[model samples]
Target: MSQMRLSLDQLTGTNRRAADILLGNDRGGYTVPSAKLYPFQWNWDSALVALGFSVFDSDRAWQEVESLLSAQWDNGMVPHIIFWKEEKSYFPGPEQWGTTDIAKTPPTSGITQPPVAATVIERLLAEDIDAHRDRAAKLLPKLDRWHQWFLDARDPDGRGVVAIMHPWESGRDNLPDWDRPLSFIDTTGVGTYHRRDTDIVNKDERPKNDDYDHYMALVRFGRDCNWNTDHIARNCPFWVAEPGMNAILRRAERDLINMATLLGQDDIAARATARLARLDAGFEQLWSETVGGYVTLDLRRDEHATGLTSGSWLAMFAGPVEPARATKMAATLTYWLSQVKHGVPSFDPNHELFDSIRYWRGPVWAMINWMIATGLIEHGETDLADRIRRDTQALIDQSDFREYFCPVTGRGGGGTDFSWTASMSLYWAA
Candidate 1:
């Protein structure tokens, strides 16, 4: 039997539809993840969306990133969600974050998301250095400050890896990797709060009520502390070192180091080089031979959280694992791929906790697949990488641009016309 592939016409249609999604979601300088569901410009979503815009609109791509950076806090931490303007649709709104006094301009959430901007900037710059050099030059120091903020605030111990105070920070909300650590958090004072997400999307497709309870409780805790890192680190109940987030930061540091060197920012390059070394060594603590892949560390408990999720595969994308470990991860990934028609379920499909329709438990995210495939290619797993790319394209073909797809059914779930989904599809189809 011959393998299926997207025809030239289909590829062109995909690109056009993806561009339309970005255009539709565009709100002047930045793009929202989705119109009604997300509304606000998210930290990581904008970074990824910028990459998507770079495909056809270079100016818009740079604008997307610049808008996101404009919300950077005085302390250098870029808030996860920048509320350029208030929208009633989103819960845990700017008021909940209480960052008006602390955050810049339009206000933002107190927490930061996975730092993917540096990596995205590097890619954009590589595509057209002359076109983006000046923009990259101006953004370079701000990006450096953001990374340094992580080192100083999240990794006060200089552990090479940073700890995420909330699951949202890892950008893998409701991931099973956080189950144990989140369980330790008490939601006694969470109070009554309505979640706009469940109201807009299917309740089953979103994080459970209990998850929201814990989420808001943590939000309140941060609000109480004025979103101070030292205070949160000292008292927050949910502190975990996520492999996926660390891998992202590690990869971004590598990219940032290159960007700094290219832009003649030697001091920033040297600092990032040293930080990358620490991150490379830090992976040792995250690896679990039992799981046969990297796992999240419960920083509060000072123990490894046992679970094999898609995040475990991000180490491949981050690219510092030993050859033997990378080989083992490839084999393990192959085994996981075999369990479902679609590739790279967020949670191992075989796991009892796996929920195909749920937000993150077992959904197949295009962004995850793209990152994993890129890592595979870097690690010389070209065949596996190609397989993932094909799977990703198949997912997009089967379902339009949605937040995520069910690995078992290839049906879209969560918010529709998702910016990052469309962004990744554009890249995959290209």
Candidate 2:
């Protein structure tokens, strides 16, 4: 309805192929045969893809989360990746998980990712046709139940903030900022492992064999524990308080509350109201007066990222940061994003751990940019907001929907003709 700036009709042949990947690969329901770098059913990928589907099918949007949510463990934790099959390219498949009879995996990652599913669902419902909204209204109770899973499982500290279960869940893989904390866990014992992702994609584009070994070592620990919930909550190397994870959690709470009211679920709405206040208070406290913005979680000590990332820009999405806090956040976002030759490096360039090409290290993901742009727009910083929006639109138009991009040159990075990027380009750029 907001008149698409880039129409579906205008999409070039490559973009058409990119958008259709989901429909084409959509197995049975939400099943996606992902790239080897990320072979499992990724949480955020599914959520974003569902957002695209809502443009056409609202019922399916809810099902996207429902399918993932249905996979939630009894403890309320939603694993980051769900493996549906055994493959050569992917390591740590459900077979590797060895938890609950690999065949009946109830979602695989012992850890959680950023809680974007609820927020995406909430937004989808808001945009739905009257009948779809009515359907979401009926499903509101179930949605609230899913949000509770995050609150109960991830917020081990009860600081009203959630901690991420793994770096993979952050949708940022191998960021340098995570290096120091991860060093504490001795990964030499991760045992013999096979990698499937490398088989399908260029090896250079994926994590190195050594890093895969380390990633597997930790996961093997999970399998040894049968993906033990209690052990994972305490011992995992990557269980830090991810800034994006928490920011999305904030949005999820607020949206869940609104969703509650939409469906006349007063009691649940009241709980969400309180939860939103609690998380907001903790978020403002993470503001770094020294660096001037929200800090990403290190997980080991439970503090912010040692340096800056786009995670700081995510504060804009969390509804409201106090004015002084927001000013610091905005200043941090502007200064840091400008420092990268690539426009928005994953980790601070000043940090020794910066890797421009690693999956989540420095690649500028279109989805994250969309969140940042839309978040800033909501805060009324229209100029900068429009700058990212237009620039992102230009990138998609030029490179044509990549899995990720090099912000410096604006060339596509990682996988090409990625589906969610193409769909979000239509929805968000619109």
Candidate 3:
């Protein structure tokens, strides 16, 4: 399992480059995923970007989270994108969201991304508790409320798992897991709107126009409902219980409980424990022996979304799964690894829909690799974990810090100098 380690000079060079990317992307308190492509501060991006900042500037890392949390909605749900300043480069801007009245100071999209903040905060505090203790204390209650919002708004049924109303919420964008659910969404009246992403990156490397139509339709629906969770839940056609999003939420809740316990917040810890128990039980619905991995549950059809995605492996990372299931997932991961030069393709490389150059179809993202490897190590699948970590570092070394790399060719794709890509390189690629 031995792999090449970066020489002292190489290690310093990698860290310096990553730090420069983080600093270049920084916009006051928050960091953008990319300067031209994303422009706005994204939910999960900031959380991961904070980790990279912690490596060089601990104080800046704390400010990143604080700035993101400042835009939390009244209902405890954090918006997926915060329109901190006017930016015309990206599509579906603040006006498209039509949430000015409801959103906080800068205004934001109504939808929420994965809850990676609590897990990230715990890691930050662990690095330097004495310096970050006060920040963690203040963030815990807000994080608690944000976690509770999932239970109240997204999973009103008290089903241990929460449902993502939009693909953007999953943060995988064009993942094949949403294909079937997205197909059911009617884009008849989505109307005309320009997309700025394809303008910045090759359209071939980005999501198809058909995907955007469905995405925009969902956005319009949310806006029409005034971003009301209850209304969207009762009527929206695209409701899915995604394994990846749930795993992230579950892991965050687990970490939140630990953070609360450390901060002596017994009440927060107790509530998070109850929430985690339900999530642990409900997560079973996502497991599909048919796919040999955890798949998405289309709530509308009451059936599982058929596909083998990198997300399934997240269950192990977010686990307490039975040993048998973890072994099965590990085997599936190994099979996928054998099919590509880079490990952990976003979608199964053998799947008919897999396209190595397309975003979230079959590309390898460093952030995903970091999580999968971390989960593998936790489950004692160190050999496979090391393989993934090695492959990830190789991709970065050969391709530079791009948004993602082609699993088959190891070529970089999407936006260049991506924030989370650089962040993961610094924090996990070492």
TM-score of 1: 0.96
Q: Give the alpha carbon lDDT tens digit for every residue of 106-210 in model 3.
A: 889999998888888999898867878998999998999999999899988877778888899999999988888898888999999999998899999998999
C-alpha positional error of residue 251 in candidate 1 after TM-score superposition, expressed in Å: 0.4
- Residues 264-361 of candidate 1 have per-residue lDDT tens digits of 99999999998889888987889877777789998888788667888889997786668888888899899998989988899989888899989889
lDDT of 2 by residue, 1-430 (tens): 1222234455456444554665654644573534435555767788887766665555665777777666666655666777655545655666666656532554375656777877787777666446566656655665566567666666656677676655566667676656666667677777676666666666765667766665776767777877665677777766667677778888878888878788778988998787777788777556665655667656468565566677777888878656776676566567656765334555665556665666666667767877887788888777767667666677777787677776666777666556667657656664
Candidate 2 to native Cα RMSD, angstroms: 3.1
Instruction: Give the winner by lDDT: 1 or 3.
Output: 3
Which ten contiguous residues of candidate 2 have the minimum total lDDT?
Answer: 1-10
Error of 2 at 32 (Å): 2.3
Scored by lDDT, the top model is: 3
Backbone N/Cα/C clashes per model: 0, 11, 2
- In order of TM-score, best first, we have 3, 1, 2
Candidate 3 or 2, higher TM-score: 3
Error of 3 at 191 (Å): 1.1
lDDT of 1 at 422: 89
Q: lDDT of each model, Cα atoms only?
A: 0.87, 0.66, 0.88
lDDT value, candidate 2, whole model: 0.66
